[model samples]
Target chain A: MNDERLERYARQLLVPGFGEAAQERLGRARVRVVGADAVASAGLVYLVQAGVGRLWIEDAEDVSPSDASGWLFAPSAVGSPRVEAARAVLAPLSRFVSIEPYPKGGVPTATLVFASSGPQALASAEAARRAGIPHVVVEPDAEGGALVVVPPGAPCYACARSTAGAGRPAQPGIAALSALGAAELVLMIANPESTPGRRIDLVRGVATARPTSRLPGCACGGPGAGAT
Target chain B: MSASAPPRVDVRAYACPMTYVKAKIALERLAAGERLEVWLAAGEPVENLPRSAAEDGHRVLAVEPLAGAPGAFRVVLEKGAGAAPEWP
Candidate 1:
């Protein structure tokens, strides 16, 4: 990251472990965000702020009144397609970082894909699984924001869905969680030294959440790579 | 069912994936064991209708030619017993 880029992301880069190098890593990375709703909006803003090099957003949805409740979008954006609205928000953040917005929903070429909890988020998760792309699905909690990380190919979003007995396809209160979850996922993908099958979580100021333990024979490369 | 029940979907103007995407949404709203009847134009759905329905764990009860419409077909599908889909 150059001096100009560092100044651009000064707030985030000022954090303890995150600095110019991390911002540089983010700039060199390609990330795919499925769905540009409230949660995705929040998560994407953070990623853009961090200067992720290439952002591929897949959503065929139009901006509705509900999206105005989130940050990064204004009331005037109502009825505009989310891709168009988001491009305007992201353009000012980083000129070096390329933004590729897909009007139709499908997998784009990316190193990491993030799906926030919702119907479309789940659909994005399913598509990523089917395409063999690494992904993370996030859901946030009500109090001070708790994050549940569904890392790619491990205890996947599908596995979490089944385990949680998620009766509704997309559960309620999923938007905030999904966005925060995706932000964390971008962080993980941006860090090159991160080992495979790593699971970590953060509860605002509480503590850093780590996976209970690596799942033995987990296809996330903790053990078995072919276990699905 | 009524003697003159409305068709569940009219897909004359849609293309691939849009057709399938619309069909999937309709299927999601249906109760288990119920059927959705779809009418499509003379293209992809002739084959894609059955393929997409099967992929969703639904049963394609019938796929027959529509009278007076060249290359068009009517597709009827019964929703399968499974967890509700995440997407429509």
Candidate 2:
């Protein structure tokens, strides 16, 4: 680590069990962040500030007027590609992190999915599970949101997510959930053994988490599971 | 056991957390039972470092003023064998 990096990450390095080794893991991580919107802006900024080495943004939507209310986009950036606009803002936050659009065949060490819909989250999380990449999925509802963290051998997102939650109008409070989601990913990346698979629900200002269990017949438990 | 010459870090130029941060990193590089010497500015850095290191399970061997540097102190810490903090 360089002198500047030591200074930049000094606070985190002081965290118990998260020293040079954890920082090295973070510096070597390639993270794929799916979806780019107001809900994802906080996670994107946290990941960059926490020093994830490479970040690939994978959203297909353009920045809409609603996105202007968030931190990553400006009112003038409406109609621009969401991923591009996100990169423009996120790139300047940290010099150590490399921000780019997700490539056609790029392999990510881990993934953070902020899908706009249930089906999208399912598909993205399933792909990450198949690839054996640890991942966290953010599901924001009207009240607050939930985050599903799936380590390599844990229950998959489909088995863990609540069945009834649906998309809601984006609000500023959701940023707290987004930041929590980023912290989950950081813990997963920094200390995989210490972070287990779990589902965390954020309601109002309270947060609750529980271990995730695989549903019967879920592919995550079958032979050749996570084989890709 | 006879005392060995421990690795030293000068953190007088930094402030509160950085002082402890540099000392912690230096301690992380050592094995349990090994000692580290940290030179920090007086006041908060001096007041907090030994307490924080002890809270993190390290042993505060000694804390005293530097021989020639006024308003500077040296802290000696023995690394502990405890595991790092895990997620909830």
Candidate 3:
């Protein structure tokens, strides 16, 4: 690795098993993010800091006044498209990573879904799974909600999503969930075959994790890779 | 048989954590039982690098002053099995 990259990701390189090889893997990752709203703010920042090679932000919504209350969007950026505004802020965080709006026919090594609604999260995650790549999905609610991790071949996020109806509007605490989700995705990118199918819930600031299983005959339990 | 000189890294210009980080990356590239020679400044680097390497399951073979280089030392390390058990 070069001096610039060494210094940029020095901390994670020190993580056991996160050697030069892992750093190179991270630098080679093309990660698509499904939302750039307040719910995705912290995760976008996390991905940039972790030095994923490319960030393809897939949001189509304008920044809301509430986005400024989150991490990335500037108050003045409200009304601009969220992906552009987010790329504007996240781009300067690390020169090692390339940030842009998602392109048509873009293929990502992994996906991160910080979807504002359940349907969007499900569809984004389903697409990633069908592509046979890793993905993480954040479901934010008023207190805090859940995030599902679907490493390739693991149970589908659709099977892992919360049974409860979409709970409430995203709360500030959703930052914890988003950041945690980003961490999960980073680890999966760094160690592709090691991530498990799981769900982590953050309710009123506490977090709990459990392994996820596929519904009978779910697509994830198809020909090759089966649910854990 | 006379042993070949081990791979070397100079961390004398860096401090604390980075000194260890540089040495660790050098170690990461080598196979288990391969030795690495790290050149670092005497005080903090001398005090920390050997301990850090040992803590990560590396063998601290020697800590000798660099010839004709003031306030710098050479730490020789042998790579250990797998990675540190501490981090999973």
Best TM-score goes to which candidate? 2
The residue-by-residue lDDT of candidate 3 on B41-81, one tens digit each, is: 98888999899898888999999999989899988999998
Query: Could you list the iRMS of every candidate?
Result: 19.0, 4.2, 4.0
Tens digits of per-residue lDDT, candidate 3, A1-228, equal: 887788888788878777777778889999999988888899999999999999999988999988888888878998999988998898888888999899999999999998777788889999999998999998887888889999988889988988876754656898888899999999899887777889999888899999998898787787886547
For candidate 2, lDDT tens digit of each residue in B8-36?
A: 99999998788888888888777788889
- Fnat of candidate 2 is 0.50
After superposing candidate 3 on the true structure, give the runs of residues whose Cα lies further than 4 Å from its correct spot. A168-170, B1-4, B84-88
Task: Write down the worst ten-residue block by lDDT for model 1 chain B.
Answer: B79-88
TM-score order, best first, reads 2, 3, 1
* TM-score for each candidate, following the candidate numbering: 0.53, 0.95, 0.92
- Candidate 1 lDDT, A1-228, residue by residue in tens: 344554466555433334445556667676787667655666777667667777887767787776777675698999998878988998787787777785355344333333334565567666665555556654433322334444344454544432232222222344445555656666565452342333334344343455523344433444332333
State the local distance difference test value for candidate 3.
0.87
- The lDDT-based order of candidates, best leading, equals 2, 3, 1
Decoy 1 TM-score against native: 0.53
Flag the better candidate by DockQ, 1 or 3: 3
Report the Cα lDDT for residue A91, model 1: 78
Q: Clashing residue pairs in candidate 3, if any?
A: none
Q: Candidate 2, which CAPRI tier?
A: acceptable
Which stretches of candidate 2 lie above 4 Å from their native place?
Answer: A224-228, B83-88
